[model samples]
Target: MTDELRTTMERVGERFNLGEYEIDAYLAVLEHGELTASEIAAETDIPQPRVYDTVRSLSDRGLVELRESRPMKIVAVDPGDAFGDIRSSLAEMVDELEARYTAPARDTEAVSLVKSRSTILRYLEEIVADAEYELALSLTPDLLRRFRDSLEERVAAGVSVELLVTPASRAPSPEEFDYESVATEARARRGITTPVIAVADGEYSIYATQDALRDDRDRYGVIFNRSALGFLVSGFYGTVLWTTAETLATDGESRPFPRTYASIRRAVKDVHELSGEFHVEVRGRDVATGNEIHLEGPVLAHEFDASEQVASFSVAGEDGDPVSVGGLVAALEDVEAQEIVLDRS
Candidate 1:
């Protein structure tokens, strides 16, 4: 063989080998079906003295079977069967490693600059998935499509999602896309100049230039980790973008059954949006009894304060008496519909 060809073969062998001579010996047996140690060393470039050790190593790794014949032959295991246990071991290792691993603490800096499009998209997806209570996003039509699954998952998990897509003409029309499955409310901004923005639970936020989506190489985004900094992004979204945007779609019937509300106003608003009389299940601690209460009744009236974060709602039981209950929104854990009978009988 040419010197160049020998070097190339050695490089190829190195990749598949557990150690020197192992891959060469395994390949020799695989091609020849069964080979004695001396035959393996002769078929490949392995040294005669190391052939037994190489084949023994292959045997121990289950890549080849060893037979104690007069010449002690090495037999190659089928590639699929040989690697099945290794594949399973690798998968198990990954699971155990992930379970035992602890992620490093994030840097406490309030603001960070990210310059890669892939990285920016990754953080955007993470922000959406991490949201607990609410999410607000301003996305290019492309980004809206890219994050459709992530947004749908969060909404299905009971996080309130409000989405804006720009420029209005480029966005999918309500008939073309199922926005109600992903976002509680969706709108289309009139201009292309609207920057991509996202705020999660009013705590984490990201703002990026349109170029971030238009040019992968020229991508950039700003991340705000602190709530104080996040508010600036949220403020810009609420005051400038949200007010001027035209509603594309709204899903009043798709609202999540309220659970662990942070804002009483939002909770009350959700309850009010329900179509007709619905049975309510309120789960909380009874202040007087110091015991857990699971109350079910028809809601009579509901009131809430956005500023004070307090809510009072009444429910009527079978005896036709209304019981008034009031609490801080944070303390009200869950209010779910027990039944939604179409008929008012």
Candidate 2:
């Protein structure tokens, strides 16, 4: 808060001062190019008594021109001319404020609440760009476009991305969009009820409503950055939202082997679809003792519940004994796998 910066900020605030009534009255006059005080009250909800004062305030700020004739007409000044001086001042003020801004502690906070649409969007982009292996996202068509480049970067880095775009009809067709470059698989859901979500490596995630992406003041988004806690988001996405979505695109190219995963469900699904013998190396915690364990051997068997709520796989250990591995916060299985690597040689 240097003196120069604080002075500039106060000057900008004073020059652009606008209240609810002033805004409504200004818009009414702008829409019609000019309006009498009575006409402004008719066009907007601004009370008849307040229209004169509101317009007078606008005139004081050089946003509107007032005629002294009968009825006192208010004319809209060209916005470009009206805001010319303050526009530069506002930009300077923003630069000064941003210099003083502190970034949110994403790595330290287990969970955080955010309200701005821009902040939510920024976190979504960071999540997609930061994924090292697995990614899951539910986005609108507009958001899909906004983060397309980041998704493509992750896909090229061999990250597995499962994308869900809502309002099926509005999603781009395969001909119009290159799905192969952005996702391992993509699905479309039929309605706007889907919340905007992004999970990175099954750990970092954000959950927000569609309303949170709009100009509305009442909406919010939540971020979850703790390890293992991400399964809450991924589980909900897989069991509830992903199951109901219609597949739109899937990468047809053969994926290179030696794949890695932080999710047991995805690992089980991939391993089950393979034909020949495949080996798995798992790093997880023993369900019984909660002690960390590392196991590696050929896959023996796997199970998936119809509802996708439960998924696990068995692998032979060094002692040639079968050990069952499950996902985060596992209950029934022998091991709660934090990471699984699948390789076929």
Candidate 3:
């Protein structure tokens, strides 16, 4: 009832892991002691069924006790103690789930596409919680409209949802919409800040997007959850699209990236892989010293900071895979190179 008491309960509730609903129940019962289940529900605006459970929870932990008679009335115990017990129980459950997921698996490969509703939810939930630094999302409007509530709940619980909704996606009548403002209320203090987005999350990344113009309703979603490989791909290409939004200066061209943010969406058949021509430098003594082999045309760019008279060359390869030592020697020899000087510093 008093400011001092509310702040105390909030800190206590945090310790015990009480959500807003639980906190409301505690405070309302504190003000009006000895109330029936229905009365508490009405006063607190919690569902009648949930109110009974909540009160029962309080009673179990000595926060509330039922008067030992007919038409049983409930009394508030030392609100803090009752709420603390609730916190400990919840914490144990989360600890269990974390342990369950952290165990090593035989299938070390990352998941490509997840389709089932329950599994998809679990996947998203894992991605949301597993995010150590940031979580990026390019949500189809339809998908967001469907699971909007579930997504908002994550935001409420201290998960920073840096969302990416396309220009074409429209809100659901403005009333069913508004993830930012409501989330700000419950999560702002807990570190859930929004309107921040990038497909890359430092070590691991996922590219989730849909073409609204071609398909208004997204049939399925894709998730790339690999760590090392995903990071390499994200480093090269993810920022290009993310840059379209983040780098836009007020006076500068609104679209900072050369093409629309969807440029990669068109070219990228497998959105998980980074496909492009990336420069690679070679270094070794005697350019023609290595075994002569067929050269990959136009793909390699040779840079000799100091030319043992080193020459430029191109090679064909994926970003994540490492270059073979022998392959480089042969490629150099195929170009009929002389005096190879490796750029290795």
Candidate 4:
């Protein structure tokens, strides 16, 4: 046989092998068009005793046809004809398996340890997609790119996204990153030693050691789902990590209103930075009747917890009436705020 023909046969053998013996027996019949069990054993290295068993296996898989002649001849079914049914069967089986498959119930589990880098990445993507109101993430440059699409989707859906990337030099530039497309704000930390961290809606969080990205085989991460442990992760993120990071880009116009008193304090600080009068609107349900309430006016005064989870502020309404409001941070989940418009009039 020509080297080209041998190479082609070798490729085909590897691509569609049933087993070593089955491939040897099938290829022997293909070479001769048809071969009796003894002829196959003579042409291929398969033992005489094993050739018949190997041929029988190929026949069972519909890869070869068997004729019940005196020696039980094996016929090479055309590769096209042989694999077409196998391909169809595989496709149908995949569809059926997909239909029956249910995603694991991981959301309710308090804690999970994920060891595969790919699985950790998948969970990160899922956490971002599942967020409704808030997201906080610290990522390496590589992960930032991997999750860019998922982040953009959630931001477009009105989920607030705060992103921090480490080793500022490795991060994409603001122009290249297009921060407005994916995040409410993006910041950069000074060093590469930071762990990869993410919190979704301030409830679900993932914390991974830096090695998680260095070696896929050595990777590990922990997921906290609505567990009190999540609070520790978020606190470290907010107080230690986020506070020390330098801003890279921000979409002030698209920033969602502060939903918690803690977020309110952050908003107030931003207003304070402006050193000017600003119009503010606060929307929430009245604790008594659960009736929706809207308070809009120029900022008067504000008070909040050091943790920013509880707050009260006074606002002057359009009617020249002073209104005072106070509530837990959890109460602000239903609230929405427009960009603070400066009332220079």
> For model 1, what is the C-alpha lDDT against the true structure?
0.72
Give candidate 3 regions above 4 Å deviation: 1-27, 31-63, 68-73, 83-101, 104-107, 114-204, 209-221, 225-345
The predicted structure with the larger TM-score, 1 or 2, is 2
RMSD per prediction, one decimal? 14.3, 3.5, 15.4, 11.1
| lDDT tens readout by residue for model 2, 1-345 | 889888887877876678999989888888999999999888999988888888989999899999999978899999999988788878887987898899866788788889998899989989998999889999999999999998889988999999999878899998899888899989999987789899888889999999889767558999998876777888889889988889889872367888889888888887666677788999989998999899988889899765566689899877788888888888888899998998884
lDDT over C-alpha atoms for residue 223 of model 3: 50
Clashing pairs in 2: none
TM-score on alpha carbons, each prediction:
0.50, 0.82, 0.33, 0.56
Candidate 3 residue lDDT tens string, 81-119: 655665765665556556656554513556465344544
What TM-score number comes out for model 1? 0.50
> How would the candidate models be sorted by TM-score, starting from the highest?
2, 4, 1, 3
Instruction: Give lDDT for model 2.
Output: 0.87
Off by over 4 Å in 4: 1-90, 253-345
lDDT of 4 by residue, 1-345 (tens): 446445545544544667788877887888889999889878889999998789888887677899998978889889889777556656655566577688888876788998877778887888888787678899999888888899999888777788999878898898777877878888899876788998876567899876886774447899998735676677678768887888899874545444332234345544544455666666655555666677777777665554444444567755777665543223433333312222321
Candidates 2 and 4, the one with greater TM-score: 2
User: On TM-score, who's better, 2 or 3?
Assistant: 2
State in Å the error of residue 79, model 2.
5.0
lDDT of 4: 0.71
